[model samples]
Target chain A: EPEVTQTPSHQVTQMGQEVILRCVPISNHLYFYWYRQILGQKVEFLVSFYNNEISEKSEIFDDQFSVERPDGSNFTLKIRSTKLEDSAMYFCASSIMMGDPYFGPGTRLTVT
Target chain B: SQQGEEDPQALSIQEGENATMNCSYKTSINNLQWYRQNSGRGLVHLILIRSNEREKHSGRLRVTLDTSKKSSSLLITASRAADTASYFCATDNGSGYSTLTFGKGTMLLVSP
Candidate 1:
């Protein structure tokens, strides 16, 4: 079965540096989303995009965070200036419709 | 928070035993899905139970939903050592589009 895939399985960056996490969603999927999981916390929704614009977002998705589908299959999440608290497992998910979403192997981001 | 809450944060069982996890959510949901994550790995799509469906089965896994109770349960029968992982229940708050809230997952250890 086709699955979502992400690059740079693990990322380590200095505090205040910019970091971009990349994902390639399933080819036919239309809705894209980003979620994060702190080491021992629940998964938190960051943002969702469809029709080339953001459909919904959570408070956790603040000014420093942005998402872009630069091309057909690539969805990227960019953090303008990373903070130490930004370390977490970031997941990318996609779905053809509004129901179940297929998730990708997450990218673990660590800012020191 | 629209996120679900799972009980028994951790569980341990013999390889041949059955493992059960329960999830409870606060608001209305369009669908509920269960995913598994191995240590430091990806989220694996397990099973999805829709608002209209009461129970679903796939191989050794079974899931049941109670909309009125706003609760769901996942059962893994005849589990193996490979089943050791964290099981998460994710809910899509509504049907219009895709934004999910996930619970803090239950960690299961299947010992051989």
Candidate 2:
């Protein structure tokens, strides 16, 4: 079965540095989303994209965060400046017209 | 308040046994989904129960949704050691391209 795939399975960056987490969603899926989970916390919604634009976002998705589908298959999350608390597992998911979303293996972002 | 909150944060069982996890949400939801995550890995889509549906099953996994009560349960029968993982419940509003709200998840350990 086709699945969402993410690059740089593990990323380590210095605090205040910019970082980009990339994902290649299933080719046919239309809706894309980004979520994050702290080491021992709930998965928090960051943003959702559809029709090549952001459809919804959470409070945590502040100015520091931005998402782009630079190409047909690539969906990326960019963090302008990383903070210690920004360290977490970031997941990319995609679905077919509000259907069940398939999540990627996730990118573990560690900011020190 | 969180949208989805799972109870019995941790559970332990042996192979061939059954495991049940429960989730409660604070508001109306269009659908409820269950996901499994291996230690430090990705979220695997398990099942989804819609607001109009009361029960759904896939393989040995059974899920029931009580829309009136705003609760859902996931049951894994005749489980194996490979079933050991953290299970999460995510809620989605019916709006188009909406984001998912995820719970803290339940950690299940199935010993061989």
Candidate 3:
């Protein structure tokens, strides 16, 4: 089965540095999303994208966070300046329809 | 608000036993989904039960939703050690490409 794929399975960056997490969602799926799990915490929603714009976002997706579909196949999440609290397992998901999403093997971001 | 909360935070059972996880949500939802994540890995979609549907099944997984009570349950039958993972329940409002709200998840350990 086709699945979402993410690059850089693990990322380590300095606290004040900028980092970008990349994802290639299923080719035919239209809706894409970003979610994060902070160690043992719940998986929290960051943002969702469709029709080339952000459809919905959570409070945690603040000014420092942004998402882009730079090209047809790549969805990227950029953190302007990373914080220690930003360290988490970031997952990318996609779906052809609403409600049901297929997730990728997450990228573990470690901000030190 | 914590939209989804799962009970029995951790469970351990031998192979061939059945495992059931329960989830309750705070608000109305259009659909509920179950996902499994191995230690430090990405989420794998297990099943989705819509608000209009009471029960759904796929392979060894069974899911049921009670809209009136805003609760759902996931049952894995005759599970194997490979089924050991953290199980989470997520919900969406059925809006356009809505964001998913996830629970803290139940850690299931299927011992051989």
Candidate 4:
């Protein structure tokens, strides 16, 4: 079974630094998404991408966050400046269609 | 804002027992999906039930969706200690968008 894969399984960064979390979605998938979970909290939607553009985003996906599919397989989430609250497990997901989404193993971001 | 909320935040059951968790969503959805997460790990997709479908089963996992009630339930039969993990319910609002809003999740502790 083909699965979504993310790079830098864990990252530690300074509070004001930038961090880029990368994901390689399934080759044939047309839609991609990013979600985050604070420790002990529910998973929160960040953004969704299709046709190399952002299709939807949540309120939490504010000025600091941006997503890019720089290449055919790579989908990345960039945080311009990390805050302590940005520390969480960030997940990348993909789907052939909208109904069933497959998730990656996630990248744990730790900002201090 | 979260679209789904799961009931019984935590459950404790003995190995071999059946475990059930409920989820309620605020709006109409295209499909509802179940995922499991082990301690500090990535989410593993379990099953998905579409709005027009009432039930679906995969291996030891069973999921039922009640569109009229905007709710869903997940049942794990003959659960083992390996099943001890946090289970989440996610909803796709039929927008043709790939984003999934997840519930707070139910932590199940299957003791041996």
- The local lDDT score (0 to 100) that residue A82 gets in candidate 2 is 97
Candidate 1 error regions (>4 Å): none
Task: Give the per-residue lDDT of model 2 (tens digit) for A14-108.
Answer: 99999999999999999999999999998898999999999999899999999999979899999999999999999999998886889999999
Residue-level lDDT tens digits of model 1 in A1-112: 8999998899999999999999999999999999999898888889999999889988999999999999888999999999999999999999998878889999999999
Error of 1 at A63 (Å): 0.8
- How far is each candidate from the true structure, as Cα RMSD in Å? 1.1, 1.0, 0.9, 1.1
TM-score of model 4's chain A: 0.99
Q: For candidate 2, write residues B2-102 as lDDT tens digits.
A: 78899789999999999999999988888999999999999998998889999999999999999888999999999999999999999987767757889
- Model 3 ranges with Cα > 4 A deviation: none
lDDT of candidates 1 onward, in order: 0.93, 0.93, 0.93, 0.93
CAPRI grade of model 4:
high
The deviation in Å at residue A91 for candidate 2 is: 0.5
Model 1 alpha-carbon miss at residue B84, Å: 0.5
Worst 10 residues of 1 chain A by lDDT: A36-45
Collision count for each candidate, in order? 0, 0, 0, 0
Worst 10 residues of 3 chain B by lDDT: B92-101
DockQ of each: 0.84, 0.83, 0.88, 0.88
TM-score of chain A of 2: 0.98
